[model samples]
Target: MKALLLAGGLGTRLRPLTENLPKPMAPVGNRPWLEHLLLHLKREGIDEFVIAVKHYPEIIQNHLGDGSRFGVQIEYAIEQSLLGTAGAIKNAESLLSDRFLVVNADIIHEVSILPLVEYHIQHKGLVTIGLTEVEDPSHYGVVQQTDNGEIVRFVEKPKQDEAPSRRINAGIYVMEKEALQWIPKNKAVSIEKETFPLLIEKNVGVFGKIINGYWMDMGTNERYRKVHWDLLDRKCSFPLKEKEQGNGIWVGKDVQIGSGVLFLPPVLIGDQVHIGERSVIGPYAVIGDGCTIGKHVRCSETILWDDCKVHDSAQLSNCIFGYDLELGASHILYQAVMNRTAGVLQG
Candidate 1:
């Protein structure tokens, strides 16, 4: 089945890291975040995709470039202006001529798409939204569904005391072509704030299904770091290309570890990485491709993107380094996110 990926948001919550790059282009492990999502969906039998893009669309277009390298066919729908969730889909209506999967690019998951499609077909609903349970429904749009999977209503961030259910919109939807009729043209519209509620009020066929899978919204800096930890811990079933050393160390090719360097397990070192002598790395550290670390450097719970350099005696804990950035010698970095921009450094 074809999938419509909504990837147009400004990535406000993940700023600095995404200031120069689009969120979809941000590095996740050794690959771009969008590439990871695309490959995962490809495994689920989706070979055709319509990627709705807006903010920094050129970066995404340049990276994916028709998706042939990833064994998928991609069609880009570039929105000239900011469009809300539903409006983005509306912008790509021409490409979706049948029942297609709609996904918000902010989420990464291993949801079984076929099962959700099947569920949508069995109920004969115009749209079936995937729902997942979270501890706090106060921050998300909660859905009320009947015992038989029919969606009754939606509550946008209800107070904890009045929350109808813990299940919130999973940002995955299976929509029929006919459902496009309800969304008006040439305007911004939110799927949660306007479209779905309108469908319910009009007595249209809208349903919800509780889905089981590993799901995370990597929309914030905290959540972005957490996704790495979750993946490294094997909490999800998504495929990774790293070689596991059976001692909690996963490394890519040509990774060099200097003598006397101490490592705590659950450490991931990417291609062409160098760890200098006497450096203590990880318990939860990810060294991105082409990174160089000097002697006696200490890194704990740190994630560095490609080509970053840490000079001698540097200490990094709970820090995120963006592409091609460098830390001077003897620098002590903690709980900070740094990204390079226009040949300058930002922290």
Candidate 2:
């Protein structure tokens, strides 16, 4: 099956991080966040892809070029202007098969696609939206489905008290070609707001398939940190490059650890990392490749991306450092989130 990946949003919620990189390009573990999605879909037996991109298309193009590295075939459909959800798919309509999968690129999920496709085939629906339950459905596109699995309507971000159901749209869908014609050409359209409503109005078959595993939208600071912790906690099936170094610690090559350094379990220090004596790290610390931790440093519940350098006596807790940022000596911080750029958030 051909899957259409919507990779072109402005990603304003992620702010400075998305200033230089696309939201889908955000790092999950050692690999790009979007790589997890592609590999997950590929594992479910979907190897063909149509990536619709608008912002920083080249980064995504250069990274996942031809999809050969991931054992898949990929085609690019670049949109000149901002096209909303449905419009992006409409823009790539020619590249898609008669029936295809449409997935939001910023999402991280492990829902099986083959089962959703099989459900769509059995129901014979023009569209089948993957739904997942959440405590607060008000912020998401709420879905109401009949007992027979037919989706009745879509209420986009309704008030919590007025919501019809807790099953919200998971941004994965099985859509048919017939649904594309309903969306106008060269115009911004939202699949949840416009296309699905119109498809329902026409009395066409629209269904819902409940997802059974992990799902998250990598769109904010907290969510970004959560994904990394989730990856470390073994919540998802993403592969890691580092090897286990015993005592709940994972390390990469050429790691230099000074004596008297205390590791508190569940820590991952990447390649070429240097930790000075008397430094305490972890119980949920992720030090990226080439990072330098000086003496008397304390780091926990933090994810430092590649090349971040922390000077002597620095303490970082509940923090995330972007690439190549520095924490001066004797500095202490908690709950600081720095974007993956020059913008440093310090105490």
lDDT of each: 0.87, 0.87
In order of listing, the candidates' clash counts read: 0, 0
Alpha-carbon lDDT of model 2: 0.87
Evaluated at residue 240, the lDDT of candidate 2 is 75
The candidate 1 region of ten consecutive residues with least summed lDDT is: 338-347
Tell me the tens digit of each residue's lDDT in model 2 across 1-347: 79999999988887776777788987777667788789888988889999999999999999999999899999999998987999999999999999999999999888878888999999887999999998998888898888998888888898999999999889999999988989988899988889898999897898998988889887888988888788778887687778887856889999999999999988888999999999999888999899999999999999888888898899888987778888877777777767556644344
Show model 1 residue runs off by greater than 4 Å. Answer: 342-347
- What shift in Å separates residue 203 of candidate 1 from its native position after superposition? 1.4
Error in Å for residue 179 of model 2 = 1.1
Task: Give a tens-digit lDDT track for model 1, residues 176-270.
Answer: 98888899887899989899999888877899888878899999889999998987887875666678886878888898889999989888888
